[model samples]
Target: MSANLLPSPMSDPIEFNNSIDLSDIGGTLTLAETTHDAWLPPEPVNTFEWLCENMHSHKGAPFNPVQFPWTKGICEAWDDPRTRNIWVKMGSRLGKTEVSLGCHACAQRHDPNTGMIGASTQRLLEKTIGDRFYGMMAKTPALADLCPPKHRQNSHKVSTRTFITYGAWSGSPTTLGDIDPKYVNLLEVSKWVREQKSESDSIELALARGSEIPDRKFLGESTPTIKGACRITKFVERASNEYFHVPCPHCNHHQRLRRNTTGERKDGGLMWDGGPEEAISPEKAYQTAHYVCESCHKNIDETQRRSMIQKGVWCGTGQRVDKNGELVGKPANGIRERSFNLSRMYGWTFTFADYARAYIESLSLSGQSFANDWEGEAWVPLKVEMEWEQLAKRLCVGDWELGQVPEGCYFLTCAVDVQVDHFVCATFGWDNRQRGCLIRHGTVDTWDQVREWIQRPYEALDGGSDMRARMTLIDSRDGNRKDEIINFCRSVNDEAGPHVYPSMGGNHGSMNLRFFRKLAIDADNEIGKKAKRNIVPGIHLIMINTTVFQEWMDNVMVNRVPGDDMSMMLPQCLIEDQDLFDQLLNEKLNKEKGIWEHIDTLVPNDMRDVFRYGRCAAEVLTNGNWARIPKHRPRQLPESEADRHQRQRRTAEQLNRNRESGGKPNQSKKRFVRRPSSTSSKRFVRRKSL
Candidate 1:
């Protein structure tokens, strides 16, 4: 045998040197000819290929890639070194759990690294990992070989809390800490409890566990729930946001699929034979459903969706490159998460008719369920809620400054909110029609500064009048400063000046219906004793039902049609202030709880609360009515011809008497009085002797 037949030292140095026997065959045979040739392993397959080969469905069917073609890119992205974090926001029954389990199986087969898998609840964890995942392993021959003898003997041996290969835990933010893993899979993140005793959320805690590893990977999948509270929604917003763009079969124009409720037939969206306004049964709507091409006025039927999906591609809308032009997901500064958002519209597994049926069925149900389950989108409770852009568009543009009141304002109302370090105030002006304009808003550190602000009168733009706030409401919720606020209100409230009232906001179920109420002073209290001595009366606190007020404000902001009776105007000065706009739109209503709450507690909503307080003060000044009072009494119409003649004759007689008396009316003379035209002629007749 030649020397070339022998295994090179570079190929297998230890084997070539130690296992070779010169006396057997002059040491010319290769390692294949040696005894250990059968021990060599086969070449490794990629993650996607492995999944296609080894993943099985619950019905004992092999995984099919053609059914869910959109998942191909996701599985490939998981294996790509450029991508670390993969977040998928999709509708239900899209094979998210199956694909995730396939990736886990691939990891266990190839790398066998310690990892973590979590679900929103313990029951979900058991169903997904304990049943479905283990069943898949048992059905697939290749995957079954990788499982331990204990798991093979009994599937229940694989605990949900600590599964095979690594730790698997359930529960929310509480169970997410004190573990380091290379791979982390979080399922249904939207259902995870957001509020935790500690500072970090479940997602944050899970991400921190893989911080020390260089090639750590995380997968987050969920159907969005609330508008701003959904974890997957926020995750996709911060990640490389990608949408699936498909080609129109007729025009071949690429566009993302969207539900068209715009009511216009020509506009491109998901349209049916009859528009949304035309009421039809859910079954009929499903049969007639078709997609309208955005570019051309062509209809795409359900039969053509499969072909379109085959040619579909993901288009990234988020920033892929950093400011330094470096590619995202580089391991240096930590992995840049890649995110994908796909709705049920583009999914080939379900027909367009199925989606339309689901939508129609959801109409009879709640909007949130329809949005999350059918539309695969986040649900916003108030559809017409005020957004920053809408508020910005309503800004009054002119030469007006921040603190200057507009020309048409007749009265002003001020609201003060006490903070730990400062006092924030928002002052609004009202015209005769109750149209509101934000006059000024600012923060001051000292109470003296707040007093100076309240005392100074604001001059109108036209210089027609200078006026102070008609009513001021100070927030008394801060227990630390309640006494101070009450004392200040007591000192400032006067008959001749603007009435200052300490205000406390109540919950939704509070019995208080009136906007403002005077709290009953305790007869045995010190303040009541002082009031008895005529020193000072106890402060009147304005008790406001915050939920009711929030609902009213939401209605005013949302349902106020153009040229309507009510209008809320913001000054141009506030258009550029993003912080104020955020504060104004910060609160969200929880439909399930029937209450309003801020999205994030850490964010300062002082401007929002102050605006609410100011609105309450305005309501108080108007006697809980939004309309302004008329300036003059209206003229009465004549009841008959005789009444008209009598009124004319009386007017002429008065003019003649004034002229005869040298342009002066009679000082003391007996005259027959007649009632106005509204009453009978003889009803008010009386004789008086003078």
Candidate 2:
């Protein structure tokens, strides 16, 4: 407060610094220690400069534009008068999050305006705040007043000195209107989720919050999630899609850096020494990877790539630059949004070999992730499609009647879909030649009826013995009586072998490339351990990768794939089941996500699901060795109706006993019984209960 002494420089912006400082008159200044820029009058600078001067990486490294030159223009665009929105659709580990965070900090410190970071979810909001506003506040002393000492982080919102708050994704359209923000950041937008249908997506709502402010800035950042349903895709399409053009080391040609391992090296692609396409291995791809310049027709090694990328410039997709670094073609006019598409090809950490190896590995896995992660491109779906009505009309293949068992049926499998009040079930029969038929499709309500369906013996029409479903899979997903399904399967499995299993379709996150996986739901519960059970009983739910199997089913039907005796035996008897046909047609592959989803979310697709499950059951039984499946045996005398009734009674009684025993083996009891002695005389004898 004294005028005689020098005033203090800028205070702690992160946790709040109140230390006062003195000028040259206070003490002999030395070059050994640097002075705080806050002590002097503030100088004008762009967002990137402010970031370099004020912020440091989480690891305490100073921000350097030369090291990460790709971020220079992107950060500068935050203060561009002509640009209102900026989108960076780039590969992983390319400093997308850091740049967005840097811009947010710059807006709060340099401009002193209200800002909001719209994270994909509440968890990401925590990561943004705790990791910076709370976690790294001490390290970033220049931002002393960034956040409160004990941040509560209530509902993903934070109250700070500069009024920088955070918001979560919302579909209501009105949620983002809570507070007007001058700067907005849509972070990891591809992961955002909505409760239900909305008039506007979360990105649009978040962007609209700062639309009216003339000096507003918006930063949209994400990897491409789905082909057509991505937020970054919208940003890039509306803007001038720019590709980073690096000068070729061989010919000094400024061309867009790309990868192409398909053709010869002379054709100009990401050339590597994977000699043959079929024999290409990751090792070979990585050890001899190099980029062939389009102009020079020469290889650009990793050493050249590092230096060239530093001098590279971002050019619009439609624009071109010649070998002499001269503009050859003009970009489209009147583009408002500034967008950039980057891939791992330009990354500093990864060598050409590393990039090629990763790409090859991704191709072997799904043939899609490389585009999404490394190429930063949306996955384009290219596969077969089907017309359900047309397929249904061609159901007159062979005389394999639907109700009657197909001739020489080797094995049977049943799949059920649980409905609100009833259960939809389908049983399929398969022969040794891999020919399968849809034997029965109907709906039943009671568990007893499900047991009957599973246990019902079908006499093979080709003078073969009776057959029963080798395996039965029930859909226990979407909160649809999962516990009940497990219990029913357990009771049946206890009486029979491991023929029945509780199964469900897995979500994208959990489902792997495999057709099915067994997930142990009951890891600790040892209900039957005390009884020395035959097999340690535990709830191991079978999770089906419906996407994979369903896609396979579509290809099998439409393309006649796996066509070595693999046939979908259609019968005229099933032609009358219009509901089944409609349900079978209900599903369509969502090319955007590379998954098969229902065309109509509301309509019933139970029979279609049942069919898919039937296919899955057949797969589980066949596994890998088709030879393991025994051929149909010779015909035997069919069980009489009385014998069948007795067997059913026994099964029902066993199921009841198993349930009553609480997963333990039933105990025995002693009883007095009358025994025949001599001639018709009866005698009382002690006997154990059978």
Candidate 3:
């Protein structure tokens, strides 16, 4: 969408868009014919109402401020006479950019005599207009004239009888200028430099530009980054620290949603399950995702997200909500500084499955990005290490053969750690809780044998049933035989299902929080340089966060018993295999470089690498749902056509009118009302693309 497709500021739909004739359609709806309603600011009003009525979004539609209940709290806070500083630490796609612009527009409507926006860099600061700010102004007839020149691009200033705004980035005080602005909006503060060229910090410099007027307001927001280094973290820590509270549709109990805290709260954050142990697929994992209520512990489907959010209220830390949904205590920071923390858990459009995808993608690295990007929390990177002797102690001594499955095993996974000369393979059988039994470990000299080994079923220690590998993950990180590894995996997958896959030991290039990402094969790599490439469609390499499994092994798995979730079990045969034990301790983390390296260069760490591979293979099948995955996954119905159409419908003139007038409905109580037409000739702006 561009500036030209923006909603017209005209109050009358006919005058706004003469292209469509509603008279011909009557009261019915159709595909070819749709609503062309437009809206504009009528007078000084509540910022939330103003945005919902007049402001156009980046999608070139009227704003839906109610989409996320948390957003409304921020918008309404702008009008609060008590608060001066309002901050929100937000997750991605939570409408931080739109809300920021709406507040600026609101400031322009009321106290917009002077305003400033500060960002991490000049590049980000200058993109405000091209991003959506200019389109927002150009869409409203009243604001279209108050701002934006002939086109809506990099608009610097909006000078009117009431408002003026200046763009500022990280720099000296000169960037803010000599004039004191009544409103200041600072974005991406986590990425901002701590200090400007002058003695004051970046945030202080931005806030210092605010006038000494009693009701002057400053807005700041960012997706939190590092734990100790984040600027937004510092700002939020000092404020009221508000959290969004929503009532459980089942229990009617209002509570804060803290993720993965089953024991601490009834709701266990975002919940999902892979199907049965043998049939789990990453593609199918998201379909079962849903939120678990903290109070009732019942599943909260995505359909309930909007309604629960609509009734949400902001409660500061240390404040609780009673059965009546009233705050039990005064706000932590009172009216001086109001702060909020928002995440996908509270978003209208987010599903539990969306987070399941993030969890899958985060398997290759430390799962901090999930906390930082989706949970709206700062993450502290862990410095992990493990001892070989300690891991050997957790080895389960059993009558099981080195090449056979254990007693309670349900499925098998094999991992091939490719070396320059040969492939070190480890076959592991897993229970539902991811407690592993190392079925076999050794070297395979040829690809033919490796392929046969992965397909063969191993006898169980209990002599019950034999199981073939559910998934075989082969390390393809080395450049030496990367092409061979990928080709072999692709051919095997083509022959069967996606049981065999080439694996990389790192974060996915796209996102950091997932356990694995089905990444596109690089068409320009050394392997792709060959002219005889037989790239299969829909066949991609799986980049597993080997570090996640590695860290779990070091910090949790190796220390726990077999009954503990995600614990590892080595066969008694490995007790005599001292070479495997030594190999496990070969790599240690280099704290200074943040990379793992061989403790002794001479020791072959194939067993260690293969151990990591087998665990990653388990994750490829399980997708990180080892803890508390629901057993029975019920099939859900496809969304109804009527619901889809209604969800996608634009704001009608009636709703816009009610919002524009602050919801003072006419005496008739009818669905439609007549209003006089105006000939402003206000044209729609194109949807601004940044």
Candidate 4:
């Protein structure tokens, strides 16, 4: 249960075997026996057997003993005194939380008086460790049996034990200061310690409180965050002081190994392509796999590396010694088990198929899956397929109107779609109040032409207008186009009247339906209110999916079965989305329901981008900072029948008052006068001012 205390009953009689197998020994050995025989048991000892034998619990017990196989790393850590902290950077579905819980339970069983702590992210601690893990304590007979009744205390907020009277405490990191722990189990170390952004992280709090408890230990484990500048890196640096040295086979010289910086070759060259392939099998030779040596330019054999290696435990800034008694720089603390460690335990006897089954069942229950619904197969095996076509007509429209040139038009916006060779530019015009069509040019604008187009109004304008361009929205989705687009937008800042805005919503012709919902709504609303202007002022342009739109118009099926004629019946011209089209084609028709159900639910990449872009545009348009003119305010008509009658009554009152006070009733003096219209068609008469 505790690090220093080993169960004697199971370990003392452990057979000396290099295989370290823990199998076929059930429910007999006691803790005292394990402690007696655990002193550096040689290979074939079946460490797995010894562990399982020691872990055998009484039948019909209130609790089940934590019965997972003891990893080599955990066993090695138990032996090393220098390794005050063991950091496990594991992958997903590795039972990290179970490891923490089982380790605590194991420690409790071994040493009833030893103290320990369990810490994780506050949210995880509450929802998972407290809620889920504690729930197991009640359900697991082995765990209940192992936990003495007096020591166990369960509650809604927490479930605690005093196994080794005040030896360990379990809580969130923030609460670590209150629980003085001898051994600390830091759960999800990446998220808890490495990914922390504030001073209040559990690691910091643990360190602060750790000094109070002398002779303390730490276990930090989680799936890696991968990103640099995380707490795991700091932990690695701190733990790097201890070295595990192995003798060189050729020279018989004991030398410590340091984990060299990855990606940089010893020759000062860089790895531009993929790094070394992952080692899938632990029994496979490690040296022969992908490692390179800087000393002799020779690769070491894996079998030899495994034979000569000792899992060395290191502490702070410790030095190493060679066979000649010469001092060497500090090296990495050699890991006994790494990525492939889990592969070894999969088929072992101690590996309960039931546990694995439960884990898989939990994942399915949580609505998690590794497979794609389409093809009824794994998602990772999903394939990419593409089709390309060109159409003469533009699929999307610009904002500018060529037939009617409105006066006092000041702002214009451009949306430029960048291709490998040429860019497609669509422009829109707005007067800070109303929006209209501007101009659209495709695959024709050279970089210079684009520059001029963005800087000033189109030369093809119907009137000789002097108003300069307002805003230009350029596309920069491609990493290659970023520099050019950014430079172009920056260059025309002073020349253009409006800001150069970069737009990222359109998905070219690749299933992009950026404004599908927004465009479908009728513009009409409450007429009494002033027109709501688009907040993101300037031209609204998007890369027209002319090909996809045409395909939709033609009701053409993309990769659909020839026998499936449902989507074929729908006209393609009105459909704006190819992803939707493809999705609909895969639906299964139920005659009884008279409806089609999707055969597979999958989120397409194009749809994701489209949603992202739509969200970005929505944020910009509805941010509530539209410009308004004080003097040229538009007249608002009243709403509601009662309000209209009230206005007419007020108008009558004003006219009667004017008639009573004037020498003669003036016909020109009318209340609530309407202004003259500018359009050529005199559709409505205007009343004179009162």
Candidate 5:
């Protein structure tokens, strides 16, 4: 949809676009002629005549002349005889409310005798779909004109009514089953699916209600959350080609897009801006180039993608032709699906300004109220400053995998967390020989800094042998930084000399509390139990174990001075010859109590966690006696006499058996009865072997 097509503040629909041939978009009948007489009552040529000029009885509202074009498109889809279901997948601020509101208006207009249902995950529904759309009938004069006099007895119908009828309107996710409706509008179907079917739930019941209505239409709409979780993903998978296929520019190939197919490039990269430049265009040109056809292997371009796709109709490989002169598939009586990003709907014209504006718009007071009503349905909150920083930090460190390598050379991992505006990264280096028993660490706030640290390790290590280096873990925790990490790793991996391996390592990475503790304990006992499992034994490496390292860290904490505030620990720790503490204090403000009221509190970074964990592993692996000894028990197990007696008994029995049988005896089954032999001074009597 172009900016020109945006819904105006006024309620009237824009001019009819007869210029658009429904044939191109695959509509069965141009909106006017498609619906059966049962669905669409004959258009009232003169409203005064239809109601006998009774203006006072109806909500005292005159019909608005212009029609809502967006609503018309949506309603047309709803009324289409071939469409059993429709899924509207969109993003924020694209006039989606009108689509639902218009459908409601149309449904009410068709059958004052029939009931229609609008549902959301919660009665509040994640977004303002129900609230906004329900309000539209009263707020928008055009929609108000469609309601029967009985449905709106007074001007304040929405306020007084429990339903969108003559009765009071009471809408709730819980009450959907009470008032059975003809047309069911399930907002955020995917969310409803998730909640209702969370564990051992019967979500299929909710999803299946519309199908039970004799010839009911089900409309589902939502902005995608995760890839597979969205109801739209399922819809798109089964949607007809006429409804989804977009044309390629050069060869005129039609491509049906689902989750993975849309905007894909021939070189196994994204056709959009974020992916790698294809072989055809390395200059970073935004224009669509030759697209190898997914079906025919023919080359295509942007022009073709537009020409082959139809907006409203569906198609398939060998399905029968519909009345619209396009290949059509079975009308899905069940769930019909379609999904596209808000950017794609707007012709992919998103700019940073647009993103920022959206970010801000979502935070306004009204937006916050709306969000709360929708169960805080916003995927990314606009008031995400703290969250953004946290995300940035996580992104910087999510997938950084560290390993103990060999020699003086160590493997280093670095990553940057990205937020709306800032990024942070921590770097880790491990010795290869001791399987990351020893680790060196650093932290930087930028990708360039990480790159520098990754490259600089070569200078610190001696000889060309150091060039062999172990794995270099990286945090690709954030989706935004996946390309950044992948590209960085690719470049580093491509370089000569030391190999840089990129693995995901973070607080949530494979290196957990247990691994860290093991690392710490392994430091003293080089051949400790933990080392036997994950680490190659007897290698020299620098790896921090988390458990023992945490113990070491507990000693590092400084209490505030007596009669001092809790805001003075950082500077004290920093000034106390701890480089890590100094770095942390410098990075943040002092906020601890006691004598160190003026000093900053030392906090753990991604590196700190890694260091501690590595230390634990090291302590455990190097000195099992010291590291493995439980603090409370603190003792070794002594072998009991029973162990020696059992060994001796087994050996003597074997020798006696061998002597009796001349070292070979055939197995035999025999039954024997023995009488207890009495001994003068013994707890038991021994019997000789027969």
Candidate 6:
């Protein structure tokens, strides 16, 4: 062989013969043997290299990792044995579907286990499996050669919902429960709708299909939708949230890429040269666009992108610190879900200029689109309506304690919301100028506890004078406690300083209408009336337009102008509680329903409701007259009839003057009016004014 090897081109090719004896030259391989070994293809060590060697695009070109370096970590996570569930919350056109297809191909080739892939709908299911998955298998020679003769003979079998050769099935979430697979891939999970009567959620149902298998794998990828409702976001929150961190070319400081609207230096957000207004014309914006290095404040051109990405790594931010403040690292002891988040800002296929143009164009079109597509963030509806930080700015350093009433407070009102286990009360003090302060807010275990707390005198912060809530409104919406609330209000006699009223919220069409409407007498007996009149005779039920008051609260909290009468003031102590602020801001206007509702159903807005009820109580007690009321003086004990008669004459004259000044006999122009004692009124004789 050594004599003839150099001369014979016609001899059987030695490279193709696997039976050639090379064991004699195996020790560190001789130079000629090393040269011969180089001719054979090296086995791929990882899934990414396997994909590159085997998978191909629709055009029959082998997969290129250089084009999308961001996928390296994603592929590594998929192959990682420690990572049981993988979630990718990413922007559109980032090759998520291709990665999923590669995973499917890998599962089919290596393990040969049953697997499943799901789309949002059946039509999408058919298109993905038939066009994308099949196209990849047909175009790639390695994957195509692995197909059995039956799969090659009948192409229809490979295109259908059930591809038996690969032991894989494809369907929508609604139909995924029937199949039992070891591997599961959910595509565009945000678009998967919940079945009306299904016991399990769409994601749960899909996961259940693979529950019997010990070596199960789950992968979910989607462009996120509404914040709370987004499945992908929820998964990312539970997983080891990993972000691709690339080093700054100039400073070498690593950071995740973010699009910045505010021109702050430390935020590490993507910065542009011009203002948002200049970005109105996308083409012009694209011409001048470049990413600013977060650490060095230097300009990063598109030319440096490839090098920066090559050195990038995925940093897990989901780790928690131990008691000693040490990093916990990846969650190896738990369920081991690994999540990856990416945006178009880091994509190589699209230039930074293209990202700027797309973001700028989307700003005028839809804010949701800009958030979901460009920023790769969840879509949050009506973000401008109420912001916790904006409301926090309304905090004032008033000279008042938590429960003490301020100097200008003329009247006090308490609003109570009844929950299953506790009553949430918000006590507010209002001045004649319509300025208000949160006197106190807390939870009481029972209605009796709430009544006792409400009746207790609250001392004035400025002076030592005492004040009590003039009116308390208890929400009677809970059917279980409605009767209890009504009975309690009825039993509280008029002698009590604070008169309790049962309040029920109503959703009327108009916002400018009366804040509270008294339930009509025998309203339930009327032909067209749907209002209930089952309360005790003395107890009055007030129908409150809660939506209007919520809007008012929102306006006062957000668009408040200094010195405006409608502007509200929060004490420094209460405003510092971020939990309270979040509770108040958790609700948003449902434009379609024309009402204010909680953005997330789990977040309680009891504080917001209490505040609304307190405002309503203020309006009802004052009878829309918020003008300053004259402070009452202490009544002098008359020593003689002459003095008493003189006092009566003065009182009659004052009454006549008040009547002539366009004031109703019972109504006061001020928010708080002092009334004469019933004993003094019965004893004194009213004489004509002289």
Candidate No. with top TM-score: 2
lDDT of each: 0.66, 0.68, 0.68, 0.38, 0.36, 0.67
Compute each candidate's TM-score over C-alphas: 0.49, 0.63, 0.57, 0.33, 0.36, 0.48
Q: In terms of TM-score, how similar is model 3 to the real structure?
A: 0.57
Q: Which stretches of candidate 4 lie above 4 Å from their native place?
A: 1-103, 113-119, 126-144, 147-174, 193-202, 224-228, 241-690
lDDT tens digits, residues 1-690, model 5? Answer: 222323466867555432334454454343443333333334423322222222121234432212111233345556665566666655544444445544545555444333443433333342233345344454555455553344434321222222352111122334444444556665544444333323322234344554656556666665443333334545644653223344444344444432123455443212334342122222233333233555555554444333333332333434444334454555443224322222232222332223322322222112322221121132222111222232223222212223222233233333333334443443333332222212234446655455455544332222222222233444344556554555554444444323332233222112322222222112222323444323322222233322223323322232212112111111111122344443322222111100112122454354344443333333333332222322231222443568646755764565465456543323322344233334445534344465
Root-mean-square deviation per candidate: 20.9, 11.4, 21.5, 24.5, 28.5, 20.8
lDDT of 6 at 96: 83
Tens-place lDDT per residue, model 2, 555-662, is: 445544222244465676666666666676677766544457788777688877887788777767776345566676456777677887887798677657655666
* Candidate order, TM-score descending: 2, 3, 1, 6, 5, 4
For model 4, how does the per-residue alpha-carbon lDDT over 1-690 read when each residue is reduced to its tens digit?
213233477566544333332344432333455454455542223222233444322222232123233244454463354545565543344444555554555554444334444444445555544444455544454455544343444321333453431221233434565665655666655444332455565566665555455345566665433234234434644554233344555554544433233545462111122333221111222212333344443444444544444322222244555555355664344432121112111212212222222222212111112111101111111122322211111222222333222343344445555667766654543433222233333344466666545544343233443334454556666756654564444434423235554444322112222222121101121111232332222223233232222222222223222122111122123235354334323433232222224445662223222222322322244231234423232333435578656755864564455345531222433344323445646644566444
lDDT by residue for model 3 over 606-630, one digit each (tens)?
8877787887778777776654433
Error of 4 at 555 (Å): 37
**Candidates 4 and 5, the one with greater TM-score:** 5
Q: Ten consecutive residues with minimal summed lDDT in candidate 1?
A: 520-529
Compare candidates 2 and 5 on TM-score and give the better one.
Answer: 2
